[model samples]
Target: MSSSSSAMLHTSPLRRYALLASNPPASTSYSTRAMAIELATLPLPASADASKFADFGREVKGVNLGSLTEEQLKEIQELLYKHDVLLFRDADVTPEQQFALTKAFDPTSAVYGHGNNKTGKTTLSILHPDLKTIPRVPQVQLIGNGMVYNHEGLAEAKLKHPHHKTFHKTHISDEDEEKGATRFYRWHIDAALYDLSPPKVTTLYGLSVPRGGKQVCRYDDGTGDELEVPLGTTAFVSGRTMFEILPPELKSLAVRSKVRYAPHPYVWMAPAHAKSTGLGIENEGLEMSFDDLPPWEQSKVKTFPILWKNPVTGGLHFQVHPCGVSELIVDPLPADAKKTGNELYPDGAHIKDLGAVRDILYKMQRPAIAPNLVYPHDWHEKDMVLFHNRGVLHTVVGAFKEDQVRAFHQCNLAASDDPIGPSEEDIKKWA
Candidate 1:
């Protein structure tokens, strides 16, 4: 693992935390609600080989997710902000209830992150083939593989789990695939990356999970790095860790850089193919032409910071969607900067060449996705997972057979506000 300086770790006064349930429902006030439930830290997934990510998720038990009160919702939102992921086992949450829990994080926001239920209609979108929205609660989408019948008002629907074979430039042979081999199906933060702000958090409830032997996820980048992952798993890596693991020069560049996304991003990248590792697109010049995209406006295009500040922890997280990014605009070193020598961008530079931009980001971000740092959640029936969208990068791992039916409800709202970037102190300290 790469070493991080003491500056990256936020120092705080320690406080006691425990597993507790409110016997006589706590008051609605923030102070009283704080006592309602304390988030209980849990062990990482059984397959995880390291303890570095123990703070990534907290397990909540004995709570009825379908009927959470305002106070409970606020506490969960706070916990989600601090831990970045929460696990609820054996949950019986409905589509409406799942949407409610997601919206509780951003009260005024009501629409789904991807054009408010416009995925299918926008055939050019990269997300078109992955999600099927629930009819009653448009915010919640029904995802997974195979045919689902009479589910939440939809009479019949065929769901297809995204497979690396379709997106990756070079995939394993069918014989190898049949032998339980797979790849991560695009590492990403769930967002439209256009007009809509990135969602603050996402909730996924597993309805039917296909049970089978573990599969080997091959990076296929010639390093021969591979992971033994559960069938149809979702892999995650912390964005904060992605930022912290960077070398000093890269760290300085990350804090001072901003990423400009392509217009109608998903549609713009529809023709592109991803790398074998699913980190970013291969540079074969297959992206859609700007003129070919649907009617779009310059004002609607997004340009976000390379680093997003965590609201609760005040940590700066490296948050970039590798596939959708078009350019990198970096600021020069501050006049009063403390560090010197071999600086990346001493004078501000705007990188417009797609290849150069992707190469720079790939070198800085790929180390964090090493096997020891990844967390592949093992899904079980009725298991609900909520993750802080801006704080981590995740991907769907492995493919499912057509006959194996798997179903899940997913929800996330386009945030009402844009993510916060680094402060002046952070720039002066790092740059």
Candidate 2:
């Protein structure tokens, strides 16, 4: 929002949540006067792995997400399905209260999962040069990085801010990126996979916060991994701790698989690239040729399900987004189950080989993006955050300074249902 941040939001006043009149500081915080909401977990990542994520994320103090109530929006959707990320530092939110707290976590949703000007008319989408539409809350998206003046209605924009040397595939030398070195610009899970649906939550907010100096993220995929982050940080990673640290035959190939995706999938992988550990595409066939994308519809493609469950921690998350996949299917092993060795496709298959579907989703989502199982987010000016778009797998890490302007205000919605897979006793207890 920038009309001098909407004129400093009328000289400050939206803080709310008083009545703590004493006694509330120990056992890692939490407060509730019928949801006056106070919470407090988010801190780990001094190279995290603190005994497996130490309860994902939380922070949220004195809640004024612009006056919530519906029992504080059902305890902020049960604290975002039990803390999959929620921070809110100094927030005063508004793009209509961050699209009504992201449509109150799917109250039958309302647009923008990639279709309100659809990444600005899909210029071969890879989110066409990173989002901007917020002309009075077009499901809130003003994103960050460069020029911005009247904002919210855009009378001058320019933004950008996504930089793994233009979608990665080996990059990290401009004297190791001017010595502050970075990477991780696209891990994903905001999902516009196809005919809209996957957005169970995602709020962001941080208006213009770009103070610099922390950079190092470089998992150049050779695994000398790196992580010191926080320059333009936003990292995160834990689809249920990437399905509880896999290896039960990749958690029974992630609850018996499903993926598919691809049609228009950001214009069929906007000419490929990723995977210097941004986790997915590096096949080099440089995509875009299902008869030249864009008019898709084998019944609007999609497919989904490599795990997902967790409606408040039934816990089975491994959610897949590996560069808009394109077929994996699987489904076999349950007869008496216990096969133990040589179990990969157990009997069923499908796959459609794009380097064997990015080598089985990079051997089951690369050890949950290790750098001690990441968290990264360090933004400040009125922060906000939220996340748990069906569990986690974020990205967009460091590098900014073409005069570093970085404003923020995101918000997610396109999900009037779809993402509840896995039960049949969670596929016979993980296939």
Best lDDT among the predictions, by candidate number: 1
Q: Evaluate residue 96 in candidate 1 and report its C-alpha lDDT on the 0 to 100 scale.
A: 63
Per-residue lDDT of model 2, residues 310-329, tens digit only = 78868878888888888888
Model 1 scores worst on lDDT over the 10 consecutive residues at 13-22
Clashing pairs in 1: none
The regions of model 1 sitting more than 4 angstroms off are 1-42, 45-51
Question: Candidate 2: where are CA atoms >4 Å away?
Answer: 1-63, 66-70, 73-75, 82-169, 172-183, 186-205, 209-252, 256-274, 280-309, 313-315, 319-383, 405-424
* lDDT of each residue in 1-431, candidate 1, tens digit only: 22322322332211101111112124321223233454667556555645667668788865666555556666787888788889998886667667767876776678999866798789878889888988878998999999999998999989999988778889899999999999988999998898999999999999999999999999999788888898998899999989988999999999999999999988988899999999999998999999999999999899999999999999988999999999999999998886568689888899999999999999988998888788888899999999999999999999899999999999999999899999999898778
lDDT of each: 0.84, 0.79
